[model samples]
Target: MENAQTQLEINQCAGINLLAAKRKLVNVLEKIRHAYKSASPEFLTKLDVSQKAWEESLEADMEMKYPLEDKRLQYGSVYPMCASGFESRLVLARVEFLKEWLKGHQDGDICSGSIIHSYSIQRDCSNIGK
Candidate 1:
């Protein structure tokens, strides 16, 4: 990106970055699915639903960010680059959010919700003060 000179080059770089981020997202999702394969069917279904909703939300956000129907005409030549870069950042943020399932939460945390406890950190937290 730093080496990109022309607007064309910059847009190309942004597209490349976006593709890479999407690949990372796919990999992270696959890891989560594999890790939680034995989880309840309802949990798996919810994960799928959540991912779909997030994608829809992201698209809506982009639409809101560039509300003009003729985005290219309104935003000019930099629209592609700017939009791609912004979308990449959003996708990377989503990847980080989804990673909570992989990282999990400490056992005995009441606020942990659906995230499984980190198996490596498993302990009888209730007995900690004993």
Candidate 2:
């Protein structure tokens, strides 16, 4: 729950440690890869990009999810899961943060973008892989 809580803090607060936050993302992606018993260097790059893009989008206060409205825009949804606008932007950015990163390729399919769940947490680890 440590990661989740920290992520929650990032989601709820206003701070842009994008690099460290991104490192956290890499760690989480690495953990998911290891937990799922899947590993690949290429996937790591893709995963890293995806994670970072999601972070960038968050830092930019934008949303990413299932193309919304019509203008051929807005993929996935926004964040905070409560208010709309920037609030939703954060929730969407943080939770589904890995979406666009993988949109460029399918090989590094990370999480299924499901609603954040209980079992999402695992034993904390620093190294994810290369």
Question: Which candidate ranks first by TM-score, i.e. highest?
Answer: 1
Worst lDDT run of 10 residues, candidate 1, spans 120-129
* Model 1 regions more than 4 Å off: 120-130
TM-score of each: 0.87, 0.31
lDDT of 1 by residue, 41-71 (tens): 7888999999999999999999999999999
Candidate 2: what lDDT?
Answer: 0.43
- Clash count for each candidate, listed in order shown: 0, 14
TM-score of 2: 0.31
- Model 1: number of clashes? 0
| Candidate 2 lDDT tens digits, 18-129 | 3445455555565555543433466556655866776586645543432244422332222332223343445445645543322222334466442222233232222435
